[model samples]
Target: MTIMVLGIFIAVLTFCLELYFKEFVIQHFHSIADQMVDKNGVEPGNIEKFYSIGYHNSLIGLIIILVGFIPIYGFPVIYGLISFTAVGVVAGYGYIMDYDVIKTMMIAFVPHAIIEIIPILYSMAVGMYINKNIIKRLYLKKNNTSKLGTMCKKGMKSYLLIVVPLFLLAALVESFITTFLIDRYL
Candidate 1:
């Protein structure tokens, strides 16, 4: 919840920043956003493209879970911030293209972005939980192995069952529904 709000703040801030420093933001940050926007919309019948998106999204979730084991309590927070910074930059660049911010968000992002964000944030939460426990055990001398093991087990179960499926669904929505809306409305 905190990370999601922060991401939105970063995105809105970036949008406002882009409004003032359009040239600078575009010069430095537009390419990433452009690539994301461009690659997001695949040909209507491209199963391969949909699979590619799902694969990448799942890979990201997997990495987030792995990152949780790093024994750094704030590592997941850093990852979330870095991930959302790109989102912010993307939002900012969309403004530069003369797209109404609300319309673009409503049409292009609101549908699948929420679906996509949930798994990523949940993955981060899982990572943060594991990382926090490990840090407590290792650095704070908590000596709670059983608790840590239980947490790990839970994280694994949720990741395999929940996060992976959500990513696939989000990818499907993004590749099909969101893309169609973008073409039709935005």
Candidate 2:
């Protein structure tokens, strides 16, 4: 819960930052936002497409976890800047493109993005906590195999087992629910 709150805070903050600096942000991250409509435009038509999408989203989650190695800044890099920024940029355009912002966003965000982002946030939280523990242990000059090693092990497990599966679920939701909602309603 705490991790989600912190991550959401950062996510909103960075989203605003991206929105505020539209000119610079768009140039650097236009593709992230731009590709949503053209690329993931509609829902998957077949089971194979869903499977492919699941793997693709899972791969993205893995990449975010790997990028979370920069001590304390990894969380922001993935959640704040990369993931949310793309969505926010698109939503910004969405506001101009459509009058019904709430419905537009609901069709775009719910089911998939929610599921996908939550675990990534948890991963960031785990990574940060593990790094903090390691730093604390180093400061205290304590060395225990089960302690630090266990922490690192646990963090990875949480990310891999917990987050990845959730992402796969999100992929399924995206391919099914998101696509359905968009196709039917939008």
Candidate 3:
């Protein structure tokens, strides 16, 4: 129930942000894409191109979720591996930067991060489903004019519904939890 509420809140927040600050968000995404392209060799292009790449990349999270759901080797094992790896990377980066702030930020982030990250993972899973079918129709079979457009439109609607509110809820959690924890514990 909490998860559902959080997801809805994030989705709504994302929608409102997009509506009021579309250019800002787009610019941010463009900057991030540019950085990624420079650092990771992603191609440089317009928003649509970046979105396509993003949609495909989101599949990795979906794959993780799927792997996590396997009966014998499930979410716990997968999560542990990911958590360990993330911690290692963060630690390495912190060491390189000679900054304890990263650790402090991580501690502050973790409480709300779980609530926020799950919806994003779920959204990516949903996006990947749409992307896979589009890829199949457009690339593999060389059938360009299929029902993919319709599917994509529907998928975008669904994504908007899920992602916007989830992000808002995440923002709320981030704002409130950190302050509350600090006031109580510090």
Candidate 4:
């Protein structure tokens, strides 16, 4: 209960912060996009396509981490597994394309990646907790809230309090870390 409450607080606070700094966020994203394009020698069209793919991938991670509440116990673990696997695959692809360049890119990214991944892990932990309740309700059908209305409301609140903050933290880590790394290393 306490953890859930804290998550909710963090999520709401983060959401508000994101809104307040919307322009800054946009500028940072533009910079990152520029960097990726230049470093990869991607054309404008290809850059757009790659960005779209990345956006979809991010959405997938967000959705899975959010909907993971449906399963309860294994949801977070499964989400983590999938997320890491996806990262690994992408990293491998990057390496295959240009190993030395990719290694440099990874170094440039590691500082921010550490911060960005923390919130994701936190969200997965929350999702796992919710998943446990879902499984309990499914199998035991005991001591559980049965109404869809109640569940939806609860789920929304939980998501708002947990997942939202995580998204914001990721943005922050990306913005600040990327800027710092680029100025220092690049």
Structural RMSD, model 3: 15.5
**TM-score to true structure, per model:** 0.81, 0.65, 0.42, 0.51
lDDT of 1: 0.79
Give per-residue lDDT, candidate 3, residue 61: 39
lDDT of 3 by residue, 84-120 (tens): 2333333433334455635544655567567556655
RMSD of 2: 4.7
Mind giving the per-residue lDDT tens digits that candidate 1 earns over 60-97?
A: 88788878789877787677566666566667777787
lDDT of 2 by residue, 1-186 (tens): 654555456556765665577677556555655654446576336466578877876666555655444445445344433555545555655554444757877886766777777776766566566555554555556565237567657767886789879988887787778777978988
CA deviation > 4 Å runs, candidate 2:
1-53, 63-69, 73-82, 144-148
User: Total clashing residue pairs per candidate?
Assistant: 0, 0, 15, 7
> Whose lDDT is greatest here?
1
Q: Encode model 4's per-residue lDDT on 102-153: one tens digit a residue.
A: 5555665565456545555665665565666667777778675445455556
Model 3 vs. true fold: TM: 0.42
The superposed Cα distance between candidate 2 and the true structure at residue 83, in angstroms, equals 2.9
> Sorted by TM-score, highest first, which candidate order results?
1, 2, 4, 3
**Against the true structure, whose TM-score is highest?**
1
Q: What is the lDDT of residue 83 in candidate 3?
A: 29
TM-score of model 2 vs. true structure: 0.65
